[model samples]
Target: MTMRICALLATMMLLVGCATDDPDITVKHRVPHGSTVAVVMFQDCGIPNQADCAGSGAAAGSIFIRILSQKPGLHVASLPRPVAASAPLTDDAAVAYANKKGYRYVINGEVQDYYRTGHLALHSDRVAMSVRVLSVKDGQVLVTYTYQEDSKTHFASPDDMLEDMAKQLATSIVVEPKKQRQGDFMFYKGNGG
Candidate 1:
């Protein structure tokens, strides 16, 4: 019985070691609280030969807008919908639009790849996307985030992955409050200053 338990534990450890690492999600900049943001249309950069596998850029942008709106300290603006095959707005144009709309930041994204593989009960969905945050004041890109995920599940869909990506992006942008100084002295009106 002891040998059997040790063997099982060793197998479990081997299996755990074989598991792949989670996808890397990076946030290059910090967005302060109470900032107004506009989410522009995402550009599709999927392979030309795999047009059918490509997802809608507009849909991705919409997902980001929806998720970012729910994040505390962010005010999302109502922006125009993106059309398929239409090129993303130039930086100048985007900055101009954001200025006109009173938004401090503009978000743009690109769907680098979107596809699924396998059939029946065996399938995996993959999504690769990049998001950028630009400042309206100077048209400078403040931060860029990129994520790629391949989820193997029987019932998972592309939309689900996209929503998850949006949630991840939203969570990455939230800025935590600065820690207070531990050595600072406290004063009260009734006590000596």
Candidate 2:
């Protein structure tokens, strides 16, 4: 079982690295610190030969909320799961719906790929996803990025990587802290809109 221990240790190390600076995470815009947000759940990509994750949309959204809620400055909640397997919402539609429902921001995404092969101490895992954060009031995209992590022929599972990805996502989405008032208007740095 020493091999198993080694594998687990390796996976733990990867997770530690994940929580640090992930170059894949790009923050284009930052919302207000106390914005209220909702998730529209993710839709799985029906890639040829990819693993079947029929409920992965809801799965990813749930995991995101589980982590993002722990972060300060953002109030997070999941919208009602859409009819168990409904068609995915477009970014515009999600933002409009959320705005009408009074949410300040909305999170929408799609899980492009997810697969894990092998088991025991020799598992290989990969998960690819794209996330979008939009201002519900005006449909301005605040933050967006796609992340792919593959423990190719390694010991980590996709679940561990996805959790770490969510943590990084939480970091990338905090509100823009720097604001300046010039002339008769105000603007925040890194404003995607």
Best by TM-score: 2
C-alpha RMSD (angstroms) for model 1: 5.1
In the range 74-162, model 2's lDDT, one tens digit per residue, is 78988864544436668988887787778889998888777767555454567788889988778888888788777744655767777
What clash pairs does model 1 have? none
Candidate 1: segments with Cα more than 4 A from true spot:
1-28, 49-55, 81-86, 116-123, 177-193
lDDT for each residue of candidate 1 in 1-193, tens digit (9 for 90 to 100): 6999999998886665345444455556667877878987777655767653444677677778888898878888757734454465666777787788888888877787776554464546667778878888878877777877665443445567778877877776757555421555687678555
TM-score of each: 0.70, 0.73
Note the Cα lDDT for every prediction shown: 0.70, 0.74
Residue 46 C-alpha lDDT in model 2: 55
